[model samples]
Target: MPRRTRVLLVLFSIVTVLCAWAGLMGLGRLTNSGFLPDDAPVRDDNRRLSAHYRAGGADLVLLVRADTDVDSAAVAAQGRAVGERVARSPGVVTAVSYWSAHDPALRSRDHRAALITVDLVENEGRATRAAQDLVPGLTGRQGPVTVSATGPAWASVEGMQQSRRDLLAGELIAVPLSTLVLLFVFRSLLAALIPLLTALVSVTGTLACLYALTFVMEVSVYAANVACALGFGLAVDYGLFVVTRFREERAAGAGPDEAVTRSTRTAGRTVAVSAGIVALSLCCLFTVPLGFIRSVAVAGVLVALLSAAATVCLVPALLSAAGALLDRWDVFARLRRARATGSAGAEEGAGWRRIGRAVCRRPVLWALAATAVLLAMLLPFGHAAFAPSDARVLPAAGEAHRTQEQLRRDFAIVPDRTVTIGLPRGTDRAALDTYARAVAALPGAAEVRTADGVYRGSTHHPAPAGTAPVAAAAPAGPVLTATAASGRESAEARRFVREIRGLPAPGGSALVSGEPVRVVDTTAVLSRALPPACLLAAAVTMLVLGSFTRSVLIPLKAVAMAVLSLGACVGGMVLIFQDGHLRGLLGGFTVTGTLDGAVALFVLVVAYALSVDYELFLLSRIREEYLTTGDNTAAVIKGVQRTGRLVTAAALLVVSAMVALAASGVTLLKVIGVGLAIGVVVDATLVRGILVPALMAWAGRWNWWLPGRLRRRAATGDRHALSTDEGAEHAH
Candidate 1:
């Protein structure tokens, strides 16, 4: 081994050890569901509501079911006791119960259930801790009431815990299954083990990076899940590319050192370009305002870069150490024997050559047919709708999901469906009345409430005696709120918020906020950002491919093919999840009639990146062959034949990892897993296998055409020119 390679190996080993240590120590500190953006109106409204009502926002609710009426003395007393206990728990900010509020909204219509709401400190970690600490004591039979805990605080804590377990479960399944697949593909234990080791290093390093990020800013628990799955898959892919190339060179009679050097020059360049494409594509997520998607972007880019670096640096060193030993311990000796009897050059991939010939025989027909199939799959996306995530993301059997469902069913008149309208402080009574009336007059508006009184349309109802407090000498600012008849996720509720926002406010300025408004605003943010993000991804992809292949048409074709594959994956998600098809096959989940906004965008970006990833792999080989042969048709055939099996194997490993993630109970994770899995399969088989070769064949020599300056350089016996001349002579 070279001294430089040995030194690099030592440095990487020490860094890997440190990363493992950091990952273990910081694992427990990660947060979950940090999706809300700082500048979101809902976030600001939550803060304001918490400040004003003390326990309005960020409250954990205990649903107390009783054998008799919940309003009975015994049940009420039990509820109060539970509330008081929770209030005294660590990190408790305030607590309210049906007994304390005397509000009808707190009790079920049948009076068999009531709520005790407890608020914790504003910090997510502290609130999660408090909820975890209090849940056990408060749940189950307590005196006359049967208590069950559910609320945002408990949900956050439980979700984080669930995510951690899911990550472990997924890794347990994916790592082993991926290993078996790798072993089958490589037919050598040592070769398979090298990729798995590279993945381990990449994943550990990614987790350590995320852990360090958490200390400075909130890092979602989902980051670990994304990191592990993608890190493993990418490491395996890059390793497969480099190892396969090295082996090919070795088989062609190059010495081990020459094989390693040549493979690094070709496959290493491809890995670097592929990594750049993935990292740049993920960087588009930064345009999204939500923290969760941004966290995914961070973790994904980190993993891609790390995986590429390991493949280029560490894998080569390992290969150098292994030398010819990589071919030892062949599990499938019969297949090796069969290969040895075949023709030396052409027969190595005779099957792939047949496929290439078949595709090129009628390139236009195959291209059109594939494009039609992809478009047909995309038809379901027209019916797709998006909703902001809620407790519905959890499994139906989960306490949080059950509680949310129960709340929605029983508490039909709750204020959560209401939109809070902020007004300038100290507004006159007449202006407040006009503002309330205007808000109430909006379409879908049910009622409006203000400090002055409640109003139905233009009519103001007088407050009952002693219900309205006398005006204080120095009164705090007044805020008016309007409740819609429909639930927050309903179309009517969204329309109501939008119509209200369009109405004139009597106050100097007004801000509307609630769940409905949040959905609208978040959707608006993403919609505005999507175009720019897509453009950025395209530009980056074009630059990377152009640099790698030195051809403008290949990059354009790659971008177009990636978009088609992404459409198919997204369309599949909508058909399966949103339309409620394949529920039995994919596990039961509540069809919200809409996908989560973040999940949709997350899947889109990820699917596109994976598409580009496979595209680059196939293109790199084709470009190499094209430069050598100076014959587009021959290059297309040779490249596809050479890379077809490697790409297929790598895709299987990645799809396995993603499918393991689909086994998670969390609907969002499942969506991501299934969506990306489908994307990989489609890109690997239909897109890369068929459309790429077909299109390249259709373009003929035009596939290699370059602009004036580069064309001049190519004709002057450059490296590419020399390769072309040598290839022509070899063919003769």
Candidate 2:
């Protein structure tokens, strides 16, 4: 065996060991989703709300009816069975169902519908367990009972579970698909396996690291899955370019040792540079305030680093070990014959090739046109409104929605908004009475009361048994409370809050905290975070590319294109999901409102980074052609033609991967997936494939222009590019 072959074997052995360890660890983290922090911003809020639910014993469940007219006994029995099961669950404190308790009016007139409330345990993991175990078990004899379980617990659990499944599925599909593509590209199974093996090693290792992270970090379920997707996707993507180049060298008849060195120096450099760009892009996720988005950014960086490692260390070793098998694909044979023919008709150029040529020939107009279209699409985003889909968060639509809705319709005196105003001890008693009177004077206000005040303006049963302590607390200033007849009259509520806020100072300030207020706050936070996040992503991209390409203007151009693509994607989502259109086509999900906070942050991160994928791919290839022969026009045409297919494939694969997420049961995941898929398609076809080349063609020398010092350095072989090219020849 050659010295190079021996070294390759050693390296492969190391990667194999590392990968095995990583697989075990990754599996452990995935299985222990509950152990992960509730890092989702929604989950964080849910945790706080769940505390209230637990304390109040206000859990919710829905009774799905097979018959429109259900009998009393059947309804009672079904409710009893479900309630009993729920009570036995880890987090359930209590259960109220038709059988356990009687509410004649609460049941549907025909007995087709009923409501149940199961108090949830305060533990986070317990909530997930209850959701998974409880709701699926609620069934009837006629048909599987459709139980929509919604509560803090179910929301947290279902979201996490669905995310985990989607990501695993993506990995399951991505690895095999990428391997197949790589095999076909190389035509040598051994050559194909090299990149796959490297990617697997990276993925396994990343998973293990993620598993370990669960102990310390609040890794979002979505983020964890996304990390795996990115790790696998990028590892294979980078390794393919490197390994293919390595095989090319071997097929060129270079000795094993020389090929290994050359492949590393060339393809290795490109991998390093590409990975750097990818890592930098992923790092931009940090700009988002939401925890899930931040987690994605963190995971993105990790995967990029892992990919870089696999391409440099792992791919080289595999190439060396494969030896002559690297070119077993008959690439050398085909190339020899092709050279002999030397005819344009024998060229691999196809429709995409022509597209590449056309794009390169008219760079500026294409770029402008694409940008305008994407910007136009983004127009709908201005009207985007985010309303939480409570149904989407739950395993099933539980009793909360129906009960709340029903209660609103029947009981006008009951407060629709459950407000919990926290105030400091010792407020003025007369002021509290004055505020109470003020609330009563409001047009829609039906009731206003402190703890001791009566809703009907008279005491019921002389404070009714258990409320005697209320008299003791009715002194001048404990914490006056009031409930409005309807939540929709937010203006009334706000007026009340303003009155309270403006009241003469007590020891501490007061805050009106409730579901409605919190929703508004979360939405506000998201809105504020978006602009900064976008700017951060742009700034980071410019900085990273500036360092790698050493051209400030090139990086700026990339950012501009990326922003346009992102805007287009957002606009499209708003039109499709927010405008209440196309719900039937997309798995019957009604677009209730704007994209949620987590998804919005996620979209910004992914769209911005993904937009750059093809831009870098095209520019790198174009730069290579330019370096080989200082002819700008020929480089643009040949480079675009050569790299276009790979970029297009990558975009399609990415879109397919994201689209697969739409199949997930969770609504938020589906939205993120669909939005990303659409964005990638538009960016790949309209922006990168057509517009980028057109812009480059228009820019000509300017695209490659750099400071004199940087231009000299760009001429010098950076280690990243040198290693990248070195591997290409060997793998051929």
Candidate 3:
């Protein structure tokens, strides 16, 4: 058996290394595009138009600033040279500039800076790579002008780089801190290492699995941050539960082998069931048609499965092999020796039982107070604004973000965000001309440049001397270069897109595509998906809990409590991240006044699963006590006493693993981390500690009521080990 275990360990090591290799390769393949569904009008139209026109809405933008007039002979010649250089670069589809086009609209309001826009290849990943390669060369001082870049491709590159840095920094802080906490909680140095090792295995495996998933479907880089963190946290959490329960069995006088068996039967089952519910919750994210949401969903499911596998298969064997040595390197020697001698058992749960009694004494008041506090946290969510991520989500001073800030402050027209009204090719010039003229008349419309000419409202102006055709249709169909317009998040840009879409085409026409339009479509799809995704997750979670407990009412109560807990967390996120409160304390991230819709959805899924995980932990102990004592109130008190510390310890481990995300430079990851940390605290204290026992006490025997068949099976010790026979199984 020892030889077999050795061989198995060797095999696991090989697989883990291979998974790491795959994950590395997968990271190279990660792309920031494909977020919008293929069928989304904006996505489809963007692709279709890119094929027809010299446009993909400018993947890279260069702001060429001259010491004086940008159009001066020297600056114009230098700027045009820069544009030509960009145009000749590999992977560049088209490049246009104020110097080359001599178009008035391309000039900044101050006339000291001019815009140089490059349209890269239609493939989003390649486009971003090309921009990344080009930005270093084009930015900084060149001949007669200083240049800086900001656009979609640059934003993508910046996001990937910052995310990598944040992930590393976060882990550095999270791992060591978590190790110390686990050392104390587990009562031994060697024992504490189990969860960390298991978490490493699960995280690497999940990353590798996610990379493989990339081949079959679109996976977002955004997904990796939350997925790996969640995988690590889950593995660590499971480790704490399984090992703690093993110690309990030993304290109860069971032999090491028997203790492993009993703990696995109890804690192992709970972890497995917890994993199933979490996986199922993540799977529900597929109902959202957006690519990012689906990517997170798939990655989360993979993490849950991998984390559960690592904890279950590896933890038990280590415990068995160590036997008497499991507590050898006791970090807390007195506590370890006391637990081993069963002396700690006397005082282990007295405090938690007292807490349970206090909460039960005023069940209604406690429940009401907890609910009200949760509701207060959720208050900020009432004003929650959802937006698509942009350079704003990056660090405040990143080149791409800084350049974007400059553009926002100085440029009258953000050409990269131009609303392109796709007019079918081969339309008559007269109809197209009319359409262009009408579009040029819209608010913030400075000039509608076309193959034929430029239009400012009803007036027609001849095309600039050297400017190539500016129409989204080479024929120029009302390409609203939103001038003096606010940012894409602003009412002006949204109104412009909305009004443009509302306009009738004079010729053959199809779609209105731009950043604002994409944001509108994304938020719309997410809004529609949120209700169904949450409902599906809730319904399925209840079913799983129902099966685990054999009590319908228990599952219902669990669902209510979990949602209430999560709602409060979401509110906290809105208050801090969106409302921009506590910015300095949270890594000094810039508040964008709105949460990324995709990130919010991901957070919701993660926090809910965690809430339910603790729910299952507490319920298992409560149900176990009730079955043994046959007194609901006593069971509630004892259950909280026995499991409260375990639940709290598990919550701490999960939080430690997640709080590393707060170390990330990226606000999105910080939001996920801090939100989850807050979530676990709420679940551990308010929901599980107070509301749970209080509600159970108020429900009395109804908490154990399981209708007809389930009650009988539960009595007979069928599946979950709730009867005396099942209890005897623990001592075997």
Candidate 4:
């Protein structure tokens, strides 16, 4: 065997063993965690209590309305029959109907409407079956009842089920399409298979890790879906980088082993640097407050890291082991070899001489134009507001949303804020009376009913402190209850929270516990975390590129391009989503002014890494030309021309995948997909093709200039610039 082949095979075997062991270990850890499907609503305390009160109460909610009246003999009988059937469900905990409560209004004022609450089995798979059973049975034209399923149970069971299907649809579409693109790009099944295998193994391993994460942290149901998308997408992208370079080297008359070595050393470095940047960017999510957002960042980082490692380590080994058999399935081998038979281009210095001559001709004009354009694209983002979505997070077409809309329209309620202020189960009557007045008098106070030892308002419903619904009789003293509005001033809600925090303990017993408060707390945490994460990612990118190019200016250029790419992507998404251009196509979801907290962070990270891919591609070629010719101009032109086609192809494939995601009914998915896709296009064509080259052409030798200290350090050990006469000729 050739020495290079021997080296690659040995390295490949070692990494293969390591990856297998790691995958097995990760799986072992995953197996220990409980299997709660992604959409399970076991997190809410009320839902948990409801579940305990009636098993599966958190998974199945039935809303039955009568247009005429719920109390009529016909309506009552219908309600009873429905309740009885629901009660007999295999996993039902309890059934509640208007007749069951004897509340006239609960039956609806016109006597036409009533609600049926059916709690199902707690297990997610069982809950799903029972919930689905309730929906079809309750719908009918003749019956007075118009039944709709709503609440955490329905979301957890039904919404989750649909989400899984949508995700599967995205994956099924992405995998095959990506494979075709890979086959075209590599011209061989063997080369394509290496990356595909790496993607599959990495994805499976990431999922197993995600399953294991449930033990150390809370993982969102959506996190798994995102992992598959990001992990596989990144895998394909990284695989493309490595595989393309390996083939390029081989076609240049390098042996299989030599090609693997060259590909690993050159393209592998770029993949590593880019992956690190991507992971670091994703880790920025740790600064956000929501567990869902944090989980996405964590999962994405894990997957990106693994994908990068696989591309650099696993792929090389596979290439080494397969040798020429790797290209055996390539239909274009003869054509490709024939193309390579042509004479090489000008030497390094000669090409650079021509490029430098052209650039020095009009440096000022080129620099001014590039800066002005990028600044204009970045301007729109200043108007961008980070708005959290409420409705779109749930399934687009669902009962919860319909019910929520109805509730909002009829009652003037905002479903965004659901909170409860907790008081001890038993408290002093005097303190309760005082607190009730204080809550009722608040500026945003809507209607506060102080019956049943609880204050109930239209706004604050969680653990309501007012009467037990208007139907239930009032409770005696030592009971806690209340509800209030979101507050008139908008800031009033936040101000009220502050007031509540400052209020005298009222016998040292009152505490506030609710989702809103949790959100506020989480936001604080996120605000502190985001900046550091961004800086860290930027630092890493700068360091890696600086090391690779041994050029201070090029690293700075890469960072600038990355930032511009992010701004362009986010700005375009804001236009598409916040502007509501595709609302109808995306299941009629209203684009909130801003993206979800988690989605924005993730899209930003992904965009940054994508920009880095182009940066590295261009820089690798440019630096190679520079070292050989000692002329920056020639390097810029030759480098752009050489990598331009590959970059364009990669961008197309990536953007296509992103556009596919944008077609999803899920609003967040659509926004993220469109944003990322648009960003890749902008980076690949506009920034990489035009802006980067123009800037380099203007900078001349300064493009490769490093400070004295850094230059000496790079000279000692980290020399990435390889400028040989043959290499220059081939590049040209």
lDDT of 1 by residue, 1-732 (tens): 678878987888899999989987777888775666656766666565456544234347788888898778888788878878877888787676777656555688888988776667765566777788889777888889888877667777777877888988999989998989988888999998888888988999999999899888878888889899999889888998899888988887778887787788878988988888899999988987788888889999999999998888888898998887998898988887787767455576678888888999999999999999999999999988887777777888888778878877887445357576666556777877777788888777877766555677778875544332111111235666677887777788888888887787655556566557777777777777788888989998888887767777988999999999988998999998898899889878888888887878888888898898888888777777866667888888888898889888989999888976788888888898999998999999899989999999999988767899987765563486457535643643
Model 4's TM-score against the true structure: 0.75
Q: Write the per-residue lDDT of candidate 2 for residues 247-343, one digit (tens) a residue.
A: 5566678787777877687667767877776777666556555555666677677777887887898777776667666667554567756765876
> Runs in model 1 with CA error above 4 Å?
1-11, 52-59, 85-94, 118-137, 334-346, 414-416, 422-441, 446-475, 478-481, 713-732
Model 3 global lDDT (CA atoms, 0 to 1): 0.80
lDDT of 1: 0.80
Per-candidate count of clashing residue pairs (backbone under 3 Å): 0, 51, 2, 36
Between 1 and 4, whose TM-score is larger?
A: 1
Q: What is the lDDT of residue 249 in candidate 1?
A: 82
Q: Is candidate 1 or candidate 2 better by lDDT?
A: 1
What is the TM-score of each predicted model, taking all chains together? Answer: 0.91, 0.76, 0.93, 0.75
Indicate whether candidate 3 or candidate 4 has the larger TM-score.
3
In model 3, pairs of residues that clash are 412-484, 471-476
For all candidates in order, the CA lDDT equals 0.80, 0.60, 0.80, 0.62
- Model 3 Cα displacement at 418 (Å)? 3.0
Where is the poorest 10-residue window by lDDT in model 2?
468-477
